[model samples]
Target: MERLTIDDMKSIELEIMDEIDRVCQAHGVQYFLGYGSLLGAVRHGGFIPWDDDMGIIMMRDQYELLMANFNEWRTTERFKLVSYRDKSSIYQFAKIVDTTTVIFENFVGKKAATGVWVDVFPLEHFSEQQGPALLKQHQRTGLLRSFAVADPSVGTNAFVKLVKRIVCPFVKNKDLYELAERLDRIALRMNAADSASTLVIDVLGEGKLEKMFSKDLLEPIRIPFEDREYFAPSGFEEYLSIQYGDWRTPPAENARPVHVMEAYRL
Candidate 1:
């Protein structure tokens, strides 16, 4: 089989997004292009030239609805939705994967399976006090994730790395699955639907809080992405500003995607 090029990857990603969009529309679940995917939509009207993957986010309630209905709604012949709830999944977030294609990233370590995939992040509610609480929860999640992956380098510091290295030998895959469940429970316990702000937990990294958006700001609005339209927060400008100051300005060439990936149709 021939290796997939950048365009091939983009084509598969777009197909996944279309599937997601269809399911969301059918069920009234709102979603938005997130992180680099959102930046690409706004700044370039499509995928960033150097980007290889896609990310989309939904609020917690809507996310739950999707999870409840995903198996029935998904393009099962072509795609599979994997979440932390799945024993085979290690990541905290969910993924919509194209089974016919494979793409691998170096940072994720060993591969249980390979496929073209888009990340599905859930935006959880948070109050001011919840920051510290969420921080603690994420710290625990980070430690468990490190052990689960058996990667000491996941932590930013030497001490945490040392601890991970020491403990990983004793950790098993089942323990990792349990940790993921705990992390999910923590997120649910801390959800602040009555609060004015929300955050996407564990999307950027463990314990890294996303920008807080007011409830009104989160109301969905249509935005042009590629040749189609998709939902984004009404306060997209504010959200983008907080996440990337002067998001309009292109970064230096050398600062672009540093890692390269290979994808292939199976």
Candidate 2:
């Protein structure tokens, strides 16, 4: 198996994204570049110089429709979709993964390393009337999500590692997973009308509140990414501002976060 360079990783991600575009187009599913992918499209013409991978998100109904028929819409045998529904999946969201290659992430144990994939996030509604109450619920999901991948290897510093070790014993992985299932059920039961003003994903790891965006951004606008055009949030300027305070300025070399990935053909 050949080891892959960052360029090779990006190429695989682009291939997956292209397939996603085809499927979404065929199903009339509206998705927009999300998280870093969105930031990259607006800040750089394509991916950030050091960035790899891509993300696309859709509203709950649109997401369901896309995934329900994704297998039939896909033209390639090399890529497949995996979601929380899969027993082996640790994430609550879906991923379009390349079966041909694998990648090791710094934050997880070696056994958790997975095939190169693009994250497919599902956007859920947040109510205006129950804003404070809903936010606390969202925060709990972040806490559980953090613990799902917790270990000494999670952080670069020894002090942080020690802290994780202290908390590791009391938290059982299966119990947390069961809690997640319950929360997902709660979300399903309390499902609100799609008219909420704010939208958020399930896992808001670090910046909990800052990760949310306005519902007004739901309307799609085409933007340039790599060599082709892709959909972006209509109110991207406002959407990005809510996510990153000064997104236009690139991070300093010394301050830039390290992204560790080791890829190889399977």
Candidate 3:
């Protein structure tokens, strides 16, 4: 795979977000620029400085509709829909363009061109509880079961596999949606430590991260998304560390934002 420079990734992120916004707006579904995307809007008012991707969340039903419509757009425009399951398990975290086209092809060999990309996450329900507490409980136990029940091939990506092992049961489809941004923090930290290593599984010198997955923490919520609703899972603080490492502290001025968009939430 080719590595993208900061500027290249930013352009891809905005282009995809524009396409996504168009579809969501036409459908009348409530779509939030979420995860790092949201953080980018908040902190940098655009793309995060070091970020290389974009993410968005909608309720399951809306997301389903959005994807269906997006597929039509893909066929009409001659763009490809990259499926992680087909590419590699590691790619499960997102879908990317199979070949350079559009900005990718145009920018190839350029100083800042990047792989074209986008990710859609489904936000589940979490009680009105504080964020940290909810994060912990999920990481401890319930999230594991959720992952186990997830499609058999989800973990083809090592980091995703580790995430499944930890938060499967307690993590419902909805919870996984909302929790994606949070877990991304952990992934980013892992990336910082070693770009080549798998943060979810490889970071654990012992079975610590995996062992943390065995605990039981579940708080389910039924929330509305698009025309329908679904259950989302969540947990507590311990789960946060296990899944995301230490995100408890606020970032320093020079510190890189965990999810570039996170700062914009407020």
Best-matching candidate per TM-score = 2
Error of 1 at 92 (Å): 1.4
lDDT of 3: 0.41
lDDT of 1: 0.72
Backbone clashes in model 1, listed as residue pairs: none
Candidate 1: regions farther than 4 A off: 112-114, 150-174, 192-206
Ranking by TM-score: 2, 1, 3
Over 1-266, each residue of candidate 2 has an lDDT whose tens digit, in order, gives 89998889988898999898887888798999987899998888888878878888777778778768787788987888875555435555668889898888876656456689998876666544554465577567656656556655567788878877776556535454455454554344323633444665433222254566767777898899989888888988887777778888998999876677789988
Q: Give TM-scores for every candidate, taking all chains together and pairing residue i with residue i.
A: 0.84, 0.87, 0.42
Cα distance off (Å), candidate 2, residue 128: 2.7
In model 3, state the lDDT of residue 27: 60
Write down the worst ten-residue block by lDDT for model 3. Answer: 198-207
Q: Model 1, 1-266: lDDT tens per residue?
A: 67888888898899988899988898788888887889898889988988888998777778788877887887556977877676646666678888898765543445434588888877666646656676676676766675666544455467877887777667635465666677777666656533345344432233456555555667788888888888777877777787778899999999787645667898
Ranking by lDDT: 1, 2, 3
lDDT of each: 0.72, 0.72, 0.41
